[model samples]
Target: MQVMEPVQMALPVTLPDDETFASYFGGENSLEVSHLKSAFDSLATTFQYTYLCGLGDSGKSHLLYATCIHAQERGLSTMLLSMREVIDFGPMVLDGLDALDVLCIDDVHLVAGNDAWEKALFNFFNRFNEPGKCLVVTADLLPDMLNISLPDLESRLKWGTTFQIRSMSDDDKAEALVKRANMRGLELSDECARFLLTRLSRDMRALLDVLDKLDHASMAAQRKLTIPFIKSTLQL
Candidate 1:
């Protein structure tokens, strides 16, 4: 069995905004996030809702964002709505469902935090019907486990292709780190990438923080990235 390490000293991870997702980690055809890609590709053809399920930092949001980009590039209209953001806007956002060909709602569990929101979601989804239109929802857990008070809404959430984000293997993460770093116009050596994987938590978001720190350190020191610089600065 693989041993999990505790995260390094860092603040809780913040989800990247749409721009950051697009700029930092564009999807690759051969990337190891294939589980997510296969499920979403099926959704593209079928116009069906798909749930991206995973534990925190399993890269669910990133995969969903990539799906949106892919959909847009195919000339399909797409909108990303965060459940946390929707809660503050009331149900008007829900009523405007006809505005897009695909709607992706992130962090659906936030609706479970309140009764009114769940009721609104149930009502909205019940009336939302458009031929060839799709809805994708992401949650920290499966719909059955979302703790939603509305049985109907809960059922609808569970009523689709559920794509769970696969946790990264050491090699998988090393590739991802190198890919993301390259997007930022930097080179990440295998040694530095593997060292980060060994010394840091396996959570991708936590791993991002380490990368961000290294980005700053590299810039501040005016040097190309090397494992020794990381070891000295991160004290690992």
Candidate 2:
């Protein structure tokens, strides 16, 4: 008799090291942040599936990763998947994910209109109903707004608490930049942070990308972050 061997699997997405609750600047979305944090809190007597909706770069991905990180720190098996990255592999990539203690899928909206993907997600959603496990999903639109071909999948997405992370104001964006700079051990003063807000794209992702460049430039130049340094390094 021939026996089948075990199947080896790996999550196709990498959760960035910097994407943590401490490093995330909630800005005006503190209530949303609190809801996510509470969902992952171990002391809580119950676990709830969490769905986060927000425009691109509003930290939906950040919060998803943060939940995975929190679960891992508690010695739970975690998987982070991005539809944008793994959809090319087909819906089979989602197989066996229901066994994980925490399963986080980002850009779930990308699966919209794909019957195979939507059906797979709907089944996966049903399998995660076991106690002590969590499934966190994020999309750029509300569950009702997603173009999912499967009505059950759309309904499943809204089965749990949903939070919409609102866009940050200009002042909040400036403060967020400074907070992120501080997380990187850079001394970004209010004036410099405000200046960056004015000069860079308003999108948080773009601002963070510019910050990465500025962090490198500051290190290479052996200078503190200032308007002059930023102007010279970014040529803005």
Candidate 3:
């Protein structure tokens, strides 16, 4: 008789290198950050299942990516799935995910009104709840607030420790921008950071994107992150 080989599950997304806990500036969401950092530890028994919710660009997804990175660094099997991207592929995409040591689902609220996905997720949640397994989910709203059609799935989501990741203040955003720039080998003055915040969107993700563009443009022009250079390059 021929032996049947176990199927391998292909990850649908790649974890960004810069989204680790070290690169993240927790700001007002320090408690959420701390919980995620230790969620995968052998001694972190209470964090077996965790949920994070916050508005857009509030660093919820970043923390999820950071969690996956932390788990993989410890030689554990991990997977981070974005519900927004995988919802179109049907619920079969969730198959075999329970085998992972750490599983993170981002933007789970995207699956709120879908019956098939909801049922599949509920089943997946039960199977993934065994010993030594960690499941972390992120959504834009609390489980009770989400428009989840399945009552059981909604209740299961709330069963875990839920945290509301608060948005950072303007001062913290400026400091975080400066720190991120420093990480990229760029010298960004506090004044310049604040200038970008004022002239552009205050969202951290948007600010970081602008910073990335500035980084490349600055390197190419051998210029500093001056306001004039920013205006010329980004047409701000």
Candidate 4:
């Protein structure tokens, strides 16, 4: 297999804090992914399409990715395309891919105002919002708020079941950490976890960064992760 060099995008500013880092799907505890499953369950299957939207860190990508995984497991043919990678398809190519049994678009909000991509997606959606194929999209905001040059594209996206994920609560954050720790076979005391919650910022990405650092440190030092250890290692 020819391995292509990995693509990287530098953050515009400093990276997010520890708390926000841990909240993404596959980045932390998949246990909390049940939130997406419950939302999917409530979706009315009348339209052959759906849109899941929310702000960054609101779990939109997580839900779409998780649902795609679930549907694939159930023998559905799935095609998941990232806007960053596939935007070159422009409007014309993308407009014709309505035949897939399932289609999941990630970070579609990035393509919102692009003329070619917009026209393509809108046409693609028009063809797919029918009997069986489910065209699913995940974006950073509600359709009406997205700055797409093609106004029709916005309305088309808002056509089907739209579910939003509220910003997670303190309790949800802690539970997510616990679940991630357990998944990694690490033991985290409630006291230690709570300490992180209070001392650190609520950014999920930052939280995962700390946890990742802790994991690597624990392995190298062959030590148990205690509150003292975390305080000293991450300077939290």
Candidate 5:
């Protein structure tokens, strides 16, 4: 049997204006959200390194982007780097990042088992040891659980605070969909939101993508989001 390499997802490097603390629904991960907010609010955080681990669509990327946006709002130089986007660019892209007030990296587990990337990351960690520099990383797994090749890098990942963002319950998910639709200037009814939850993938990101489609369909048809309309538009 031939084993295929994991295909990295190409996420946009720019933080979407919609991705902010107010936009996020913490659900079971409220403490994690608070920690991220504090880290972004203060230049001198008690923990210089913060590692967030959670399954995809568990709001890990949301908090990371929120942190970047919050920091930028506070007049801090911020960069929201996606490892999946920059893994192809080589580790040289990590150079000159230590000067930033806040540096946030997403999908960091994508570099597991790569020697060059690990070395560069290890060196970057060492170089970013200044008192007020903050480095926040997100991955699908905890640092120790990742199949990292470099022990030094692995150890460095655990040097500071680590938190796991929890998946929301079904009720919370339904509320979140409605809230997101409201933010988009659309009204997503409770019944319609529940219908989507039952039919679509449980992943928040996937559900949000479907919501985008529904938003366009509703506008084009000049229709409210009725269950029948959703069924016809999405063929559910």
Candidate 6:
């Protein structure tokens, strides 16, 4: 018997160590989070073609990366491609991707209205329909709302279960910031979190980026994440 190996690609992107499910603050997106976490289970047939749609900073990319990490941990062959970064490389970037046990395409809507990419994705979807293969896609819009010029490609997008990641409320965002801080061994009070929210962009990605900067700054200065320290370190 010939042995088969997992398909390995030299992807330009790297997943963040902190973007796992444990660090993700689900808030109102608990169901979507749960579904993505189990996407690779043997009995998760309905999740073979999962689609996540939401506005920017609504955690779509985070969930996609988290799913890939989960699948990889289970010893499954997994690949995560961010279309936003690879669109310029042309549709050939998707070549042989179906060979992986799990494939996650981030910002898939970036290929919308591009004929070649759309057609290539349509074909990839068809080729990835095997029983054990799972395809997870994230986009800023729903399948029907995408500006895809290819009718068949749009139809293929709807073949899977779709979930809209809801935006986090202010209180939820504050709580999430504190939880993320705790995960990093930093103490971020609810008041401090609310203060940071007021001072920085409310977008989760931006907030997280700022939090990362604070994490570094606090470690260097050996200072807690107090409002005064945050303002001085981040120039807020």
- In candidate 1, stretches whose alpha carbon ends up further than 4 angstroms from where it belongs are 1-46, 169-171, 183-185, 197-203, 209-222, 231-236
Candidate with maximal TM-score = 6
After TM-score superposition, the amount by which residue 46's alpha carbon in candidate 5 deviates from its true location, in angstroms, is 6.2
Off by over 4 Å in 2: 1-16, 27-29, 42-47
TM-score of 1: 0.70
Q: If both were scored by TM-score, which would come out higher, candidate 4 or candidate 6?
A: 6
Among all windows of 10 consecutive residues in model 5, the one with the lowest summed lDDT is 1-10
Off by over 4 Å in 3: 1-16, 27-29, 43-47
**Model 4 score (lDDT):** 0.64
Cα miss at 181, model 6 (Å)?
0.7
Q: Better model by lDDT, 1 or 5?
A: 5
As a whole number from 0 to 100, the lDDT of residue 34 in candidate 2 is 73
Scored by CA lDDT, what does every candidate get? 0.68, 0.78, 0.80, 0.64, 0.81, 0.80
Q: Candidate 3 lDDT, tens digit per residue, 124-169?
A: 9888777677888999999989999999999899988898877778
List, residue by residue over 1-236, the lDDT tens digit for candidate 2.
Answer: 12222221134543336768887778324776677667767433555788888885578877877777777777667777888889988999987777677778888999999888999988888877767677788898999898778889999999888888876777877887788888889898989888887877888777878888899999998999888889999887
Model 1 lDDT vs. the true structure?
0.68
Q: Write the per-residue lDDT of candidate 1 for residues 49-95, one digit (tens) a residue.
A: 67777775566667656666656665666666777665787766677
Which residue pairs show backbone clashes in model 5?
none
**Candidate 4, residues 38-130: lDDT per residue as tens digits?**
434533453456676666466565455555665555555556677766676555546435655567787789886677777777777777675
Backbone clash pairs in model 1 (N, Cα, C under 3 Å; residues 3+ apart or in different chains), count: 0
Model 6 scores a C-alpha lDDT of 0.80
lDDT of 5 by residue, 1-236 (tens): 12222222225633335767787887324787777776644546543679998875678788877777777666667777899888999998987776776788898999999999999999999988776678889899999899999999999988878998777778878988898899999999999999999998987777888888999999999999999999999998
Q: Tell me the alpha-carbon RMSD of every candidate.
A: 9.5, 4.5, 4.0, 7.1, 7.4, 2.8
